[model samples]
Target: MKLKSVFINTTNCITPLGLDVETNIRNISKGISGIRLHKNLVYAEQPFYASIIENSLIEEAFSSVSSSEEYTRLEKMMILALMPVIKKMNPVFDEKTILIVSTTKGNITQLSTISETSAQSADLSLMAQKIASFFGFITEPVIVSNACVSGILSLAVAKRLIQSEACNQAFVVAGDEFSKFVLSGFNCFQAVSNEPCQPYSVNRKGVTLGEAAAAACVSANGQNALAEIVGDGAINDANHISGPSRTGEGLFRSVERAMKEAEIKSEQIDYINAHGTATSFNDEMEAIAFNRSRLGNVPLNSLKGYYGHTLGASGLLETVIGIESLNSGKLYPSIGFDEMGLSQALNIITQNEEKELNYLLKTASGFGGCNTAVLFKKAK
Candidate 1:
């Protein structure tokens, strides 16, 4: 049986850079860095660089569509990011449509302050249900919380659902908010970068966290679609809990499988939106993986410098910007890169350059040794 093609029809994002896709793309095109220093916010008495949505802004946006007093910050951001696309689709909540929520640390901020109902408020499933119910989704919501891969992996799941006739359309939303829980965990690992992130740079320190919510509508309908999801793969090398494989084993296999499923050779790939977290191990591992897959010559970049590491939202946020890149026929530079930092060479994008991007590859690696690769093509 021939599987139906899944296309990304529309997308939107709410981040420090902007509240919509076009705005975020314009800011990134001008080399604007959203990651900035915030004093005593997530980490008290310690200044850290992060990309965060201001509380006032969130309240202001939420007030337009809702007067509810019970929504949490994460829920508000998710609603704001998804509201425009939802309005555009105005999709009926029926058996044919499904909602999927992807997040790493939903309502983790509840842990920062002691509350009698703290554990209940921090429930990921409850958060997913609230978002789904807010939109009147008839079907029970699905949740994807697999580390950083949650964002992109949700897309792959949506594609499969359509192909399998489980649903005719899907709205996938992925988000994470900056909180003491996340910051403190990273601090414990010494993975929090002091300066703005610089992926694939010799002087790169570590990752800078960020907060964002990104959503996309996926369907079998091809009309006016932004891009087609051609292929996808997920793998876990199980190298380590917190560290990536020394040899890029899992990433290499994931990219290889995705390319094979797309029925495209490495040379056909026009651009790569890599998961360069600016960590020393991650950059080096990705470089080795690209070289292993013979994708070393493809021009690639990491948007972390502009968005910081938005955790669960990074994959979808980066992919949305990538769609813009392909439509504009221009490659955005990896914002904070200065020089080649890995032993294996990658043709990193240094400056904005005009290129006809037909096939784009997006790769992401996370804790628990999970890595995902997804291939997308221009809808034409």
Candidate 2:
């Protein structure tokens, strides 16, 4: 089904860089890196660090939802960040607003404390449904929890639903909280970085894990005055679940399809927000895929240096980041890069520079060999 018009109405995020998009963009565009030492984590005494959202700020922003101590941090973050925005939309209680939420590690980060699953248990879908119920939506919310790609894929699903007229509108919210579960999983895979992640760097080692949550409102037609979701696509690597494709083949295919769906030629892409997780294999593989796509030279950058790998939220949040960058006509640098890696000629926007951006490309690759590409066109 062809959508008459599906546009991103409103977007917001809660990241380590800052609580909201405005604050996050201001710091990112200024080339500010947000990774810091997590003295409480296993290697906090050592050199490794993480990009964690300030606890105080999160408490302040999200306290209204779970005023008591019932809700978990991740749940509160989603509810608090989305409540105001959703209310502003003035949705009706009985209106069918589909909720497509994404998360790599949901409230499950805290599930180890409880063995039995119950209504009060912190099921990821329950967290999403709680938010939906609070907003008075009558539709049954569908939850998507596909590793880091969940967030981006959630948006892609929402866009399709709008195109199919399955719902009048869809609320895409995704989040992942930092926990020993996530850190240990990555650590077991040796994906922790001793320093802030440096994407596209010759000396890159591993990813610096981070936590965040984000929400975006998409409608059948453009109602809010903002960027439109012009093109989007997703694909599986079918190669590896934990590691990226050797030649970045899956990512390359995803980008190719996404650009085609948008009817955007490779040259038309003005900027690319790469899923540069700061890992040796991931970065190099992405480099190879991007180089093969020939869009690597499209003035690429990774916000991971600033916000770390926000996992699921990385895609939607970074899509928001790309829109902000395009609207402001500024390109951000890939933080922590001292040396260029691989033989690819992809130009990493290594400095905060001003440029006229028309279409910004956002790409994300995650576990299970999932990759997503979304092209957001600047409203002319």
TM of each candidate vs. truth: 0.98, 0.94
Candidate 1 stretches greater than 4 Å from native: none
The top-ranked prediction according to lDDT is: 1
Write one digit per residue (lDDT tens) for candidate 1, span 195-295.
99899999999999999999999999999999999999999977898899989999999998889889999999999999999999999999999999999
Candidate 2: residue 27 lDDT (0-100): 82
Give the per-residue lDDT digits (tens) of candidate 2, residues 113-179: 6567643476766787777776777887888887777878887888888888788788888888777
RMSD of 1: 1.0
Candidate that scores best on TM-score:
1
Model 2 clash pairs? Answer: none
TM-score of predicted structure 1: 0.98
Q: What is the lDDT of candidate 1?
A: 0.92
As for candidate 1, its clashing pairs are none
